[model samples]
Target: MSIRGYLQILRPVNALVAGIAVLLGVLVAGGEVTPVLFLLVVAVFCITGAGNAVNDYYDREIDAINRPDRPIPSGAVSIRGAAVYSAVLFLFGIACAAFVHPFCFGIACLNSLLLVAYAARLKGVPLAGNIVVSYLAGSIFLFGGAAAGTDGLLLNLPLAGIVFLPMTAREILKDAEDIEGDREGGARTLPMVTGVLTSCRIAAVLAAGAVLLSLLPVVPWWGWWYLGMIALADLVILYAVASAFRCTTSACVRESGATSMLKTGMFAALGVLLFWALIG
Candidate 1:
């Protein structure tokens, strides 16, 4: 594959977001910023990139209709080549995690399998696919906490929920946005079954749930700084929810204003968590 193909397969921006999630996990669990944390971040990044590539491999046909510019659909990378690259990345990620901690290794292995399963089959199975994606998003925090070799999973719980709920919402919105290609490809997504308006309402509900959850006690050592930061994050989430409600057509959802806002909120939340952990 060409270097451009490799970069496209990696989805560098998403991988970086996932790597930062691992770092936040360490900070939340009060783990020392050792070289081990760096290893964990790299492992997560590789694994996430692998997942993205494999997903593209499986969704090549659908992408041809929905996203012709994607690596596989555009012929930038062959399906077999992408599959091999994904396998190599997965193994390398597992190896890195194994060197970090036994718990991290176990999570990495399971996550890799789940990623493959999602790409191969679950992605077309309606709500099941969306939930699986949500779980994968939440697992980043758990994987990070595991790398710390501590029992402070509680520290990671709220962060996991924060990531999970909004991701679930986004997954549904994406399904709604891709309804045309998905239907053409015989996908049984929620929007296909219940229609776009209903799916949008469901997504909005999930977004609201995330915002409400954010208001409760999350970080044990958090102070006013954390509260203020999180409140601002909540507003961003709320705005996303509002935008979801405003989306009157599939085309609007495809524009993904709400999804972008959610991503921004997630990154802002992580920054706040890191700062709070340091100052506290």
Candidate 2:
């Protein structure tokens, strides 16, 4: 494989973004930013990369059907080789975490196990799989606290939960977009197990829940700016979800757009979160 192709296999951008998010949590939570936390960042990046690799490998056939240009099924990396590569990365990541703190390492171990399980089987269990992926996405924040040798600020966790809740909902909505490929592949995703309409309604409700929960931190502890930004974000999400609710013709299209918009909103809100976490 060419260097570029192999680089794609590593999914460095995805890993780097995730690792930085981890660091951001520690910083925002007012945890000690030490050398060990730095090391933990690298370790988590490697593990995230490994998980991506394994996911790509496992998804070869399905990806070939859905994403023909992907590295593995596209013939850039051998499937067996990718599996071994992923295993090595995961082991190294866990080993580094183990060295930092046993508590953190235990979390790392479980996280790795969950990733493998999700990629292997849980991904086929409808809402269960979505919950697994969504909760794990949120746990990345918690892992940051663990790596920093603390449980993070309580106030910060509430915000984290708010962020995670919608992200989880969006994940399910994204799954709704993939109903055809998943069903064709015999995978049991939410849209496949239940009808697309049901899955979508559930996604909308979860998204609404996220909006309500996000306001919890804004009451007295947070400043006006915090509440305003969160409200703005929530309003955007609600509008998009409302559109989904209104669409009766092609629920899939609305669901797909809504999920994509949710992701965009999530990324955009990082600045608002940083502002509140740092200044307020």
Give RMSD to native, each candidate.
1.6, 2.7
Q: What is the lDDT of residue 42 in candidate 1?
A: 92
| Candidate 2 lDDT over residue span 1-280, tens digit each | 5566567887897677667676666765567667878767777888888888888887777888777898887788888888988899999988887876676688788888888888888888877777777766676666776654555634346656766777777877767666666766778786666666776677788888888877765423465667788788787787666656543333454544887677766665655665555554
Record all residue pairs in model 2 with backbone atoms less than 3 Å apart, i.e. clashing.
none
lDDT of 2 at 231: 81
Full-model lDDT, candidate 2: 0.71
How does model 1 fare in lDDT? Answer: 0.84
Alpha-carbon deviation at 191 in model 2, angstroms: 1.1
Error of 1 at 250 (Å): 1.2
Regions more than 4 Å wrong, model 1: 246-248
Evaluated at residue 213, the lDDT of candidate 2 is 79
Query: Which pairs of residues collide in candidate 1?
Result: none
* Runs in model 2 lying further than 4 Å from the true structure: 148-156, 218-221, 246-251, 254-256
For model 1 the local lDDT of residue 209 reads: 90
State the weakest 10-residue window (summed lDDT) of model 2.
246-255
